[model samples]
Target: MAKVIMTCGNLCSGKSTYAEKLGKELRAVVLSIDELMTTVLGRELGDMHDEYVRRCEQYLYKKAAETALAGTDVIIDWGFWKKAQRGYAREFFRQQGIDCEFHYIAVSNEEWERRIAARNAEVLNGRSDVYHIDSGLLEKFRTMFEEPDRQEMDMWIE
Candidate 1:
Protein backbone atom coordinates (compact mmCIF):
# COMPACT_ATOMS: atom_id res chain seq x y z
CA MET A 1 0.00 0.00 0.00
CA ALA A 2 1.12 3.52 -0.73
CA LYS A 3 1.82 5.95 2.10
CA VAL A 4 1.90 9.71 2.45
CA ILE A 5 4.83 11.02 4.47
CA MET A 6 3.93 14.45 5.82
CA THR A 7 6.73 16.69 7.06
CA CYS A 8 6.08 18.99 9.99
CA GLY A 9 8.44 21.80 10.91
CA ASN A 10 9.07 25.53 11.02
CA LEU A 11 10.87 27.54 8.37
CA CYS A 12 14.51 26.61 7.57
CA SER A 13 14.09 23.39 9.51
CA GLY A 14 15.47 21.13 6.76
CA LYS A 15 12.12 19.66 5.75
CA SER A 16 12.96 19.78 2.08
CA THR A 17 16.35 18.13 2.58
CA TYR A 18 14.80 15.37 4.66
CA ALA A 19 11.95 14.97 2.22
CA GLU A 20 14.40 14.46 -0.63
CA LYS A 21 16.28 11.85 1.37
CA LEU A 22 13.11 10.08 2.45
CA GLY A 23 11.66 10.13 -1.04
CA LYS A 24 14.74 8.39 -2.38
CA GLU A 25 14.60 5.80 0.37
CA LEU A 26 10.92 5.09 -0.25
CA ARG A 27 11.15 5.48 -4.02
CA ALA A 28 8.42 8.11 -3.81
CA VAL A 29 7.60 11.43 -5.39
CA VAL A 30 8.56 14.49 -3.32
CA LEU A 31 6.20 17.44 -3.57
CA SER A 32 7.19 20.79 -2.09
CA ILE A 33 4.89 23.82 -1.86
CA ASP A 34 7.90 26.16 -1.83
CA GLU A 35 9.26 24.62 -5.00
CA LEU A 36 5.91 24.85 -6.69
CA MET A 37 5.22 28.42 -5.61
CA THR A 38 8.70 29.63 -6.47
CA THR A 39 8.49 28.02 -9.90
CA VAL A 40 5.17 29.64 -10.69
CA LEU A 41 5.44 32.95 -8.89
CA GLY A 42 9.20 33.44 -8.79
CA ARG A 43 9.40 33.41 -4.99
CA GLU A 44 7.47 36.58 -4.25
CA LEU A 45 3.68 36.69 -3.86
CA GLY A 46 3.50 39.90 -1.76
CA ASP A 47 0.14 40.56 -0.03
CA MET A 48 -1.58 37.54 -1.54
CA HIS A 49 1.05 35.12 -0.27
CA ASP A 50 -1.15 33.37 2.28
CA GLU A 51 -4.07 33.01 -0.12
CA TYR A 52 -1.83 31.66 -2.86
CA VAL A 53 -0.17 29.25 -0.48
CA ARG A 54 -3.52 27.88 0.61
CA ARG A 55 -4.58 27.36 -2.96
CA CYS A 56 -1.33 25.64 -3.83
CA GLU A 57 -1.55 23.37 -0.78
CA GLN A 58 -5.09 22.32 -1.65
CA TYR A 59 -4.00 21.43 -5.15
CA LEU A 60 -1.03 19.46 -3.85
CA TYR A 61 -3.16 17.54 -1.39
CA LYS A 62 -5.47 16.49 -4.21
CA LYS A 63 -2.51 15.40 -6.30
CA ALA A 64 -1.06 13.49 -3.36
CA ALA A 65 -4.31 11.59 -2.83
CA GLU A 66 -4.49 10.66 -6.48
CA THR A 67 -0.85 9.54 -6.54
CA ALA A 68 -1.17 7.53 -3.34
CA LEU A 69 -4.30 5.84 -4.66
CA ALA A 70 -2.30 4.87 -7.72
CA GLY A 71 0.07 2.91 -5.42
CA THR A 72 2.95 5.36 -5.41
CA ASP A 73 4.39 6.74 -2.22
CA VAL A 74 4.50 10.54 -1.72
CA ILE A 75 6.47 12.86 0.54
CA ILE A 76 4.89 16.27 1.10
CA ASP A 77 7.48 18.85 2.10
CA TRP A 78 5.18 21.54 3.39
CA GLY A 79 5.71 23.14 6.77
CA PHE A 80 2.66 21.61 8.41
CA TRP A 81 3.00 24.36 11.02
CA LYS A 82 -0.27 23.91 12.87
CA LYS A 83 -1.91 21.05 14.68
CA ALA A 84 -5.14 21.54 12.78
CA GLN A 85 -3.33 21.22 9.46
CA ARG A 86 -1.70 18.03 10.61
CA GLY A 87 -5.01 16.62 11.79
CA TYR A 88 -6.70 17.53 8.54
CA ALA A 89 -3.97 15.85 6.50
CA ARG A 90 -4.14 12.66 8.54
CA GLU A 91 -7.92 12.49 8.29
CA PHE A 92 -7.87 13.22 4.61
CA PHE A 93 -5.52 10.32 3.92
CA ARG A 94 -7.40 8.07 6.31
CA GLN A 95 -10.65 8.73 4.47
CA GLN A 96 -8.93 7.67 1.27
CA GLY A 97 -7.59 4.49 2.88
CA ILE A 98 -4.00 5.63 2.41
CA ASP A 99 -1.38 5.21 5.10
CA CYS A 100 0.06 8.46 6.49
CA GLU A 101 3.18 9.07 8.56
CA PHE A 102 4.09 12.32 10.24
CA HIS A 103 7.75 13.18 10.53
CA TYR A 104 8.80 16.22 12.50
CA ILE A 105 12.14 17.78 11.72
CA ALA A 106 13.15 19.28 15.02
CA VAL A 107 15.77 22.01 14.82
CA SER A 108 17.29 24.09 17.56
CA ASN A 109 16.73 27.83 17.37
CA GLU A 110 20.44 28.43 16.83
CA GLU A 111 20.57 25.95 13.99
CA TRP A 112 17.40 27.34 12.48
CA GLU A 113 18.82 30.84 12.52
CA ARG A 114 22.03 29.61 10.97
CA ARG A 115 20.10 27.89 8.22
CA ILE A 116 18.05 31.00 7.60
CA ALA A 117 21.20 33.03 7.17
CA ALA A 118 22.65 30.46 4.76
CA ARG A 119 19.43 30.27 2.78
CA ASN A 120 19.19 34.04 2.57
CA ALA A 121 22.72 34.15 1.22
CA GLU A 122 21.80 31.58 -1.41
CA VAL A 123 18.74 33.50 -2.41
CA LEU A 124 20.81 36.67 -2.73
CA ASN A 125 23.28 34.88 -4.97
CA GLY A 126 20.50 33.46 -7.12
CA ARG A 127 21.63 29.96 -6.23
CA SER A 128 18.31 28.97 -4.70
CA ASP A 129 14.67 29.62 -5.45
CA VAL A 130 13.65 30.01 -1.81
CA TYR A 131 12.63 33.30 -0.24
CA HIS A 132 14.87 35.00 2.25
CA ILE A 133 13.45 35.32 5.75
CA ASP A 134 13.79 38.94 6.73
CA SER A 135 13.46 40.03 10.37
CA GLY A 136 9.78 40.92 10.12
CA LEU A 137 8.88 37.71 8.36
CA LEU A 138 10.91 35.68 10.81
CA GLU A 139 9.12 37.24 13.76
CA LYS A 140 5.77 36.66 12.10
CA PHE A 141 6.60 33.05 11.41
CA ARG A 142 7.78 32.52 14.96
CA THR A 143 4.48 33.74 16.31
CA MET A 144 2.41 31.76 13.83
CA PHE A 145 4.26 28.41 13.77
CA GLU A 146 2.80 25.83 16.11
CA GLU A 147 5.28 23.33 17.40
CA PRO A 148 3.91 19.80 17.47
CA ASP A 149 3.97 17.85 20.69
CA ARG A 150 5.59 14.42 20.86
CA GLN A 151 2.21 12.70 20.74
CA GLU A 152 1.47 14.24 17.37
CA MET A 153 4.55 12.94 15.62
CA ASP A 154 5.29 9.47 14.31
CA MET A 155 9.01 10.23 14.15
CA TRP A 156 11.30 13.07 15.13
CA ILE A 157 14.55 13.96 13.42
CA GLU A 158 16.95 16.54 14.78
Candidate 2:
Protein backbone atom coordinates (compact mmCIF):
# COMPACT_ATOMS: atom_id res chain seq x y z
CA MET A 1 0.00 0.00 0.00
CA ALA A 2 1.28 3.41 -0.84
CA LYS A 3 1.43 6.02 1.92
CA VAL A 4 1.87 9.72 2.49
CA ILE A 5 4.55 10.59 5.00
CA MET A 6 4.04 14.03 6.49
CA THR A 7 6.87 15.80 8.28
CA CYS A 8 6.22 17.94 11.33
CA GLY A 9 8.84 20.31 12.67
CA ASN A 10 9.84 23.90 13.25
CA LEU A 11 12.20 25.99 11.12
CA CYS A 12 15.74 24.57 10.80
CA SER A 13 14.58 21.39 12.50
CA GLY A 14 16.00 19.30 9.61
CA LYS A 15 12.67 18.33 8.11
CA SER A 16 13.93 18.51 4.54
CA THR A 17 17.09 16.60 5.35
CA TYR A 18 15.14 13.84 7.04
CA ALA A 19 12.56 13.76 4.28
CA GLU A 20 15.29 13.21 1.72
CA LYS A 21 16.73 10.32 3.69
CA LEU A 22 13.35 8.73 4.41
CA GLY A 23 12.12 9.21 0.88
CA LYS A 24 15.11 7.34 -0.45
CA GLU A 25 14.67 4.60 2.13
CA LEU A 26 10.98 4.23 1.37
CA ARG A 27 11.37 4.74 -2.39
CA ALA A 28 8.99 7.68 -2.19
CA VAL A 29 8.76 10.98 -4.01
CA VAL A 30 9.57 13.93 -1.79
CA LEU A 31 7.27 16.89 -2.30
CA SER A 32 8.83 19.91 -0.69
CA ILE A 33 6.85 23.13 -0.24
CA ASP A 34 9.98 25.17 0.29
CA GLU A 35 11.53 23.98 -2.92
CA LEU A 36 8.35 24.64 -4.82
CA MET A 37 7.92 28.12 -3.44
CA THR A 38 11.54 29.10 -3.84
CA THR A 39 11.85 27.73 -7.35
CA VAL A 40 8.67 29.39 -8.57
CA LEU A 41 8.67 32.51 -6.47
CA GLY A 42 12.45 33.15 -6.36
CA ARG A 43 12.99 32.50 -2.64
CA GLU A 44 10.93 35.41 -1.42
CA LEU A 45 7.22 36.20 -1.41
CA GLY A 46 7.32 39.28 0.83
CA ASP A 47 4.04 40.30 2.53
CA MET A 48 2.04 37.61 0.75
CA HIS A 49 4.40 34.84 1.88
CA ASP A 50 1.94 33.01 4.13
CA GLU A 51 -0.86 33.28 1.60
CA TYR A 52 1.40 32.01 -1.13
CA VAL A 53 2.58 29.12 1.02
CA ARG A 54 -0.99 28.15 1.81
CA ARG A 55 -1.86 28.04 -1.86
CA CYS A 56 1.23 25.99 -2.68
CA GLU A 57 0.46 23.58 0.16
CA GLN A 58 -3.07 23.02 -1.11
CA TYR A 59 -1.72 22.18 -4.52
CA LEU A 60 0.90 19.84 -3.09
CA TYR A 61 -1.67 18.04 -0.95
CA LYS A 62 -3.80 17.36 -4.00
CA LYS A 63 -0.80 16.17 -5.95
CA ALA A 64 0.32 13.95 -3.10
CA ALA A 65 -3.09 12.30 -2.99
CA GLU A 66 -2.97 11.67 -6.68
CA THR A 67 0.49 10.19 -6.49
CA ALA A 68 -0.39 7.94 -3.58
CA LEU A 69 -3.56 6.80 -5.32
CA ALA A 70 -1.38 5.70 -8.18
CA GLY A 71 0.40 3.31 -5.80
CA THR A 72 3.45 5.49 -5.29
CA ASP A 73 4.63 6.66 -1.90
CA VAL A 74 5.03 10.37 -1.20
CA ILE A 75 6.84 12.32 1.48
CA ILE A 76 5.56 15.82 2.16
CA ASP A 77 8.25 18.10 3.58
CA TRP A 78 6.05 21.04 4.49
CA GLY A 79 6.73 21.11 8.21
CA PHE A 80 3.17 20.46 9.36
CA TRP A 81 3.59 22.70 12.37
CA LYS A 82 0.12 22.66 13.85
CA LYS A 83 -1.92 19.77 15.18
CA ALA A 84 -4.97 20.81 13.19
CA GLN A 85 -2.91 20.73 10.02
CA ARG A 86 -1.70 17.24 10.85
CA GLY A 87 -5.25 16.10 11.58
CA TYR A 88 -6.46 17.51 8.30
CA ALA A 89 -3.70 15.73 6.41
CA ARG A 90 -4.48 12.43 8.09
CA GLU A 91 -8.19 12.74 7.35
CA PHE A 92 -7.56 13.85 3.81
CA PHE A 93 -5.60 10.69 3.07
CA ARG A 94 -8.07 8.55 5.01
CA GLN A 95 -10.92 9.90 2.89
CA GLN A 96 -8.99 8.90 -0.20
CA GLY A 97 -8.43 5.43 1.19
CA ILE A 98 -4.73 6.11 1.37
CA ASP A 99 -2.40 5.47 4.28
CA CYS A 100 -0.69 8.42 5.99
CA GLU A 101 2.11 8.54 8.51
CA PHE A 102 3.25 11.52 10.55
CA HIS A 103 6.90 11.97 11.40
CA TYR A 104 8.03 14.67 13.78
CA ILE A 105 11.63 15.86 13.82
CA ALA A 106 12.39 17.16 17.28
CA VAL A 107 15.38 19.44 17.77
CA SER A 108 16.63 21.16 20.88
CA ASN A 109 16.56 24.97 20.87
CA GLU A 110 20.34 25.27 20.93
CA GLU A 111 20.80 22.89 18.04
CA TRP A 112 17.98 24.42 16.09
CA GLU A 113 19.49 27.86 16.49
CA ARG A 114 22.87 26.62 15.39
CA ARG A 115 21.37 24.94 12.34
CA ILE A 116 19.49 28.09 11.46
CA ALA A 117 22.67 30.10 11.62
CA ALA A 118 24.48 27.66 9.38
CA ARG A 119 21.63 27.61 6.92
CA ASN A 120 21.57 31.37 6.86
CA ALA A 121 25.26 31.37 6.12
CA GLU A 122 24.75 28.99 3.25
CA VAL A 123 22.07 31.20 1.80
CA LEU A 124 24.33 34.19 2.19
CA ASN A 125 27.10 32.36 0.37
CA GLY A 126 24.73 31.46 -2.46
CA ARG A 127 25.29 27.80 -1.76
CA SER A 128 21.72 26.95 -0.88
CA ASP A 129 18.26 27.61 -2.25
CA VAL A 130 16.70 28.13 1.16
CA TYR A 131 15.65 31.46 2.57
CA HIS A 132 17.61 33.19 5.29
CA ILE A 133 15.97 33.66 8.66
CA ASP A 134 16.22 37.06 10.23
CA SER A 135 15.26 37.84 13.80
CA GLY A 136 11.78 38.99 12.85
CA LEU A 137 11.09 36.00 10.65
CA LEU A 138 12.45 33.69 13.31
CA GLU A 139 10.14 35.18 15.91
CA LYS A 140 7.17 34.95 13.58
CA PHE A 141 7.85 31.30 12.85
CA ARG A 142 8.43 30.59 16.55
CA THR A 143 5.04 32.00 17.40
CA MET A 144 3.29 30.25 14.54
CA PHE A 145 4.71 26.76 15.06
CA GLU A 146 2.81 24.40 17.35
CA GLU A 147 4.78 21.51 18.82
CA PRO A 148 3.07 18.15 18.37
CA ASP A 149 2.63 15.68 21.21
CA ARG A 150 3.96 12.13 20.99
CA GLN A 151 0.52 10.66 20.31
CA GLU A 152 0.13 12.85 17.25
CA MET A 153 3.17 11.44 15.50
CA ASP A 154 3.81 7.96 14.12
CA MET A 155 7.57 8.45 14.17
CA TRP A 156 9.97 10.75 15.94
CA ILE A 157 13.49 11.80 14.96
CA GLU A 158 15.34 13.67 17.65
> Best by lDDT, which number?
1
Clash list (residue pairs), candidate 2? none
Quality of model 2 by C-alpha lDDT: 0.91
Backbone clash numbers for all candidates listed = 0, 0
**Model 2 spans > 4 angstroms off:** none
The lDDT of model 1 is 0.93
Could you give candidate 1's per-residue lDDT for residues 62-155 as a string of tens digits? 9999999999999999999989999999999999899999999999999989989999999899997667789998999889899999999999
- Model 2, position 40: C-alpha lDDT score: 88
The CA root-mean-square deviation of candidate 2, after full C-alpha superposition on the true structure, stands at 1.0
Taking all chains together, each candidate's TM-score versus the true structure is: 0.96, 0.96
